[model samples]
Target: MGTDKPLIGFIGTGVMGKSMAQNLMDSGYSIAVFTRTKDKAQELLDKGAVWKESVAELANSADIIITIVGYPTDVESVYFNEGGIIENARQGTYVIDMTTSKPKLAVEIFEKAKARGISALDAPVSGGDIGAKSGKLAIMVGGEQQAFHEVKPIFNVLGENIILQGDAGAGQHTKLANQITIATNMIGVCEAIAYARKTGLNPSRVLDSITTGAAGSFSLSKLAPRMLEGDFAPGFYVKHFIKDMTIALESAEEMGLSTPGLSLSLELYQELAEKGEEDSGTQALIKLFD
Candidate 1:
């Protein structure tokens, strides 16, 4: 809070948020962090991030707030509740929600924040844990143009592919579209390796042949290797992926759009989650094939 740069309040120090907050601290910005679990903030505290005991405390202390919490319900609780960001943050503060949540909720936050003179942007991210650490995540933002420009430098520190898609809930809509693509892609990646192993070819050899070809994808190039090496750790969790797919599917149905691929993939991911792989990395979806 005593820094020349605007103090950054980082909420939700999870798998990706931890690395992202650390990167900001590493870039010399003072960070105030709060999560439901204090221990999760320890690594960042060791690296010079100041710890706050609650969302309201952090909200009042920082000029810019960034949150990447789990679930739409969590997002609502932090932004709309009595002692939350909307009530506690100073006038003219910038609040960025990087959580993949409901588009309607994003619009509500934007309208409410605007009335209270706070700038709120729904800026959901992609590229997983690796990108968060490397600062290469693709950020899809939606808010007023002026507000987006004001936060672009901060966005630059957190991601490479940053774009202000439109207004209010547009970022969330874009993220749902991203989830739809990834849901189908994960299935294809799983089946490719499964087919290769069943037909007596080296899965890695098959990957080498196809990774740079027409079949190339992030799941193929990055996650396939993780699957082969049996690393089911949460780069991105199966539960979260299923959450995204569910949001995408609901949005599609609302628009009278048909997404058979998204529907099937959601079914597969739901099956994977029900099998007790919810906390595992989405790459573990391949286990369904096995």
Candidate 2:
């Protein structure tokens, strides 16, 4: 086919991926998409994107393939499953995986891609659903510089901050750090809210006060309102945050690091999940203390 414009295919159209793909299509890329459920692709298809039947079909048509699936296993399956991307992807095509996966998996996938003369990068993101919708996520990318530059334009359309961390698995490592920080910050915010309640202080007012002082953070400003309103809707699911935290702590363990805070948060998330709050927003972590 002709190469007038890059053929961009996106997999995983959940909360974050769907908005990201929509922004790319809005920015005028030739878009093709596939999700596990056919109906999830409907909005994009209606907006001028073509739908592919499977990962292989999507890879076949795309010059640049972007994956933003859920967990490490799902990320692996998208590229290596039956009728997956590697089965049909051609040499020299670029693949960027934006899933917050294990760094080891990024290294593994990068080696496999390099063996086939393809370029691969692990580029995970942050800034949550609002960021995804507003095209303001922070992207941490790892791969060859040339391939990063090649994809930078599309990333520019989808994110506000983009950093090339290092080699093959650096992005995933950076993402682990991100999750660790998030886990601690989330715990801190939830605990502060719980503390305020126990002390007969107006939790909302407590948040409003400290939020302007040194005790403030992005998490406090954003999630505090949700926690106060008892709105634990899945802007980002507790299950996904737990997955990220578990991956972070595991990575830390492999490096012989001490992260007691992360361990505590991980256990708390596990407890929350076991109580059927896994699908709820991570702000529901407050429920554990209540």
Could you tell me every candidate's TM-score relative to the true structure?
A: 0.98, 0.96
Expressed as tens digits, the lDDT of each residue in 59-119 for candidate 2 is 9889999999999999889888777877678887899999999999999889988888889
Badly placed stretches (over 4 Å) of model 2 are 1-4
| Number of backbone-clashing residue pairs for each candidate, in the order shown | 0, 0
* Candidate 1 per-residue lDDT over residues 30-66, each given as its tens digit: 8999999999999999888998988999999999999
Q: Model 1 scores what on Cα lDDT?
A: 0.93
The residue pairs in collision within model 2 are: none
In candidate 1, stretches whose alpha carbon ends up further than 4 angstroms from where it belongs are 1-3
Best by lDDT: 1
